[model samples]
Target: MPVTELTTDAEALTMTLIADVDAPVERLWRAFTDPRQLERFWGPPGWPATFTEFDFTVGGRARYHMTSPKGELSRGAWEFVRIDEPQSFEVLDTFVEADGTVFEGFPAMRMAYSFEPTETGSRLRNVTYFASHEALEQAVEMGAVEGSQLAMGQLDAVLHDLREYAQGKGTRTELLDDQHVRITRLIDGPQELVWRAHTEPALLEKWMLGPDGWRMSACEVDAVAGGRYRYAWEPLDPAAGTAFGFDGEVVLIEPIRRMVTTEHMTDTDYPSTLNDLSLYEEDGATLVTLLVEYPDRETRDAVLATGMTDGMEASYARLEGVLVSLPG
Candidate 1:
């Protein structure tokens, strides 16, 4: 097991677990900050986590659920209290209802995670501060200790395979669940440029065009929260296909880091989908992750059947070419 030490202080009302990870501090920190990596090990073996919303900023909140083997879901939420980049961060963790209401019966805790370099690789220190002695006892009874050990034990594999997740990988898609899908691409540019390419109409028009012989005829975007964006595409030849477009209202925006929107076909009765886009920069390249939540499994399958991934890949490849010509 990676966990080298586990201790609880009744007087302090805290539980601390220290694990020695065979990865650098930077990699370890990214595993925690990135929801895709975090979900891979946040839950025990049988209970896998799926983060529906992850806004990684101070005062931002994350909502996730762990699914049991029997298909039962245990919901949870985390309000980020403090963040120090690749060093340490703290959060207020609480059990919540599926709709995100806090469950008062369960114990809420202040959890702090710290990372430091070790001779082999790095060391992770996780401390959970309970509200009271009774609360700590309650959590222990709920298998909190064993559960944490198992969760951290699964982290090694994730760290070892980090490069395959985002580096040099072309646009890739992962079916997170029946309704949610994750698409990731590593853009050969900095986060600022990548964010600009996504939000700026002029930049978007240049590369957002999908397959060959298509052009972005109309591109209007208001990147602020509550703003609306419309994009239309037309084939160079009329024989290709009919012109189509999409419109969406931005639900949330966090500058260059994250954006969430509700998207829909311009004149279709189909239910709208939620698109959560996040950008993270490491070295000189930025990793763009888009978490799309469709209405249902049928809708998701239908969308994939339309060769959506291929179109996305074409656009992303074009985006990289555009970024290369921009002034750094």
Candidate 2:
């Protein structure tokens, strides 16, 4: 029902599929970037796919195999050409062997995927172009149309489970641009609970430690526009003998929906940074996206090289446990 249209153009030697998904653009985009998520709905009905190799960057290659109910397997590969975040991307798709050998006898196709935000949710468009009319005809004869329809139809159910699983797992982080980085996670429980975990000092102290054996020894929060907050962490093993922290002011606040804050380190010479956090409710789960901006690309790269992303991931994993223990 979510698949609104599937059309083939003989003149252009292409097949286009349009689907209206119930999930947000970011969530749908994750289904494409995350190989494990893509494996779930990549094949038609009874034929499930397994990705043996996946590298989502531009010019990277992804190899996968689909297993039919009769135990037959179909192997393919995609050479990524362009990746435009949550909006669109293009790839060269071709049949391949398990060892990554291309099947030259089969026609290779170019595929483009676009995601557009709609009032209800998101509209996904996929177009596959062939080398010639004969190639297109061959694809159609090989059940490409039916297989695509069945595969796209599985997206709704896959998205439902993905959102549910993300509630406590699968937090992801990526570089958005030269000076911006984005981290996203689905928090279990409602938006208000996630908001408290982010803004309340006591809850923050429980999960915001940067590394193992480090504990937040002091935390103070004034959760309001123009309010100030401070957090200090010390090694749990007192013998480590080092303490570090950050203090900042809340620049903007929108209750449980959004917060913007400035952060200045107390233990380092790193330049101050701004963080914008936004929360959205999706089927009773809270999707949190944190965008961090730096003054310049050099500073951003320097901080990233310090393994901040790994620290954030560690902290987020702890946050999930804390969320699980909280009252829903």
Candidate 3:
């Protein structure tokens, strides 16, 4: 119902469909990029598509098949031509056989998708260009317009489920004991990138800062065990004049797996704490668990009262963007 318009130009040999999705640009983009998400709404109503192979990069290929209620299989493939993050992408779409061969005499269309941000959500424009008027007419006769409309109509439900799943993965904090607290999150990226964000000084500065108007002034990391590390943050706004920092020593380092360290807040009265961070890969995502142990219950409670968990959650949210920007 949200599909705003569908148009065709026989002279230009193109078909265009525009839809406004009630989801952010990032969520809508993920629906097109993530293979699991793509499969859910790739075909028309009652004709669910199963993607056998999906690689969403420039020059990559995707192979899939849709099965109708009568048990007929419609195999299809796409060769990615260009991809521009959350903006647009172009691909060569073609009908194919089960053995990965293109269907003889079938028209191969060049498809382009553009996502634009609007006040309500994202506006998606899809255009398919045919080789000639004959090809365009052939596709139209095959119900391309109806099939595409049905597929795009299903995207709303997929986006809703993805949003709910993301909310469930938000930072979870638990009081393990009087002197220990554990914070865990299911991050979007892989373990390798998550580990790098934690151990690398440059990446660490991006999300380690506590709040707005604060900047990590200095960051140094010697990742090996027994190596020293220090980080300092200052208020960027001159009026909010305050500086605070922390220094630590790595007690253990396991690349892409775990790290243990001793940390002390330089400008606070709180006692030093031991931090144990563990990373695990689950279903292509990284789960990060951080345990902090203070010297005593009073110190732990004091730190908790400072709303540290809120800052951690905010910083972790920013880290998600950093992970998305990283090269694959």
Question: What are the lDDT scores of the predictions, listed in order?
Answer: 0.87, 0.82, 0.82
lDDT of 1 by residue, 125-172 (tens): 999999999999999998888889878876775787434446666888
The model with the greater TM-score, 2 or 3, is 2
Alpha carbon deviation, residue 269, candidate 2 (Å)? 4.3
lDDT of residue 183 for candidate 3? 79
- Clash pairs (backbone) in predicted model 1: none
The lDDT, on a scale of 0 to 1, for candidate 1 is 0.87
TM, every model? 0.61, 0.51, 0.50
Residue 138 shift from truth in candidate 2, angstroms? 47
Candidate 3's displacement at residue 5, Å, is 0.8
> What does candidate 2's lDDT look like per residue over 264-310, in tens digits?
99767778888878776767777777778788999888888887877
**Whose lDDT is greatest here?**
1
Clash-forming residue pairs, model 2: none
Q: In candidate 3, which residue pairs get closer than 3 Å at backbone N, Cα or C atoms, i.e. clash?
A: none
Q: How many steric clashes between backbone atoms does each model show?
A: 0, 0, 0
Cα lDDT of candidate 2 equals 0.82
